[model samples]
Target: MLTMKNVTKVFRTEMVETHALRELTLEVKSGEFVAVTGPSGSGKTTFLNIAGLLDDFTGGEYRLDGVEVRQLGDRARSKLRNEKIGFVFQSFNLIPDLNLFDNVDVPLRYRGFTRGERRQRIERALERVGLASRIRHFPAELSGGQQQRVAIARAIAGDPKLLLADEPTGNLDSQMAREVMQLLEELNAGGTVVVIVTHDPEIAARAQRNVHIVDGVASHLDRGPALVSPALRTA
Candidate 1:
């Protein structure tokens, strides 16, 4: 559903040029769950930002669900991003004063859904994440895992075609991480394409495929066993 061909990202300063991605070519098919693993400063974040349309690439091409994003205007890109992509970040990114219901409702509102429709979506997304009972809870009232679930709920509330998660379990304990991963797996089983950027090997290994990045390039790609993946294992 997503394709990047010869994509290169360069950050330029007056004195230095930093290449975040070098001729990166990759494809994520519909319904696939793929993991991206790399060390700090390995361009995983840059790739995610580009994939999410949060930033632009300096060279090459990107096709998201068949539309070429390389030339899309900012307005068009923003609309497409809202309609086609969902993001789950390690920081949760929830508003402290917003309850779970409203947290999930925020993005839907941006999409101009009616109150009834937004409510339905918010409810369903929360239910899917096993947080239906906490819809009234605020961010400060929930644990780290629960807050992250709310973030996930907010992401999927729009029925996005692609889910991009960056270090989704980085802040959670083992039990919470497992719960979140299981939720992602369940979502993938139902046909939403999921791509995760993580440093945790065990989490990356659970995915159907793994992509490893080093020095601004994808150096390894693998499918199958967890032990064979390049990222460092945690327990």
Candidate 2:
């Protein structure tokens, strides 16, 4: 679960000041799939960065899974982020030279997992993303969709409590995007909380809940029962 209260982020320069987020209060519960949609400059990325601990807010409180993120030191924040959160990015962020297996192995290596343990995690994660047989393939050799799946695999290898994706399907074709969305849905159904930042209405519509960001705050949120429409789940 995630909670934010009066979150504010400001960017300052010698001559100009910009407020990226202003008292943006948002919450995502366990097992929830949330889509954060907004126009450019609406602070969607700022919110995602703050939520994922990549950046600190200028003011307000943010708690992730009951831990106060705003108060933690950098080292502690890094540890918490690695342990509790997974990330998927728009650009796939894969190491160009590493094979699929090694790419997924990178994060687990930081955790001090032995070769056997890392191997197992990588295998399972790849299988979950439907990329088991392509473990030896390089990113350049795979299709865009396969590359994105590999990114998802890398994120899930740690068995994170929360998954944060930014423009996850932005580079893929419609069919590939749909497939990726379906995979995300499946992951959410299995109890991993997911929050995505997207501009596509169709992509946002697939999430169990939608939050529209405007002027550095959550402009709209549907507080209806946590109900996922049936159609969003199908391939």
- Return the TM-score for each candidate structure: 0.94, 0.94
Backbone-clash count (model 2):
0
Clash count list over all predictions: 0, 0
lDDT of 1: 0.90
| lDDT for residue 175 in candidate 1, whole number 0-100 | 79
Residue-level lDDT of model 2, residues 1-235, one tens digit each, is 9999999999999999999999988889999999999998899999999999999899999999999998899888988888889999999999999999999998788777899999999999999999999999999999999999999999999999999999999999877888889889889999999999998777787787899998887876663433433443355
Candidate number achieving the greatest TM-score relative to the actual structure = 1
| Pairs with backbone N, CA or C atoms under 3 Å apart (clashes), candidate 1 | none
Worst 10 residues of 2 by lDDT: 223-232
Task: Provide C-alpha RMSD values for all models, in order.
Answer: 2.7, 2.6
Per-residue lDDT tens digits of candidate 1, residues 146-196?
A: 999999999899999999999999999877887788888888998999999
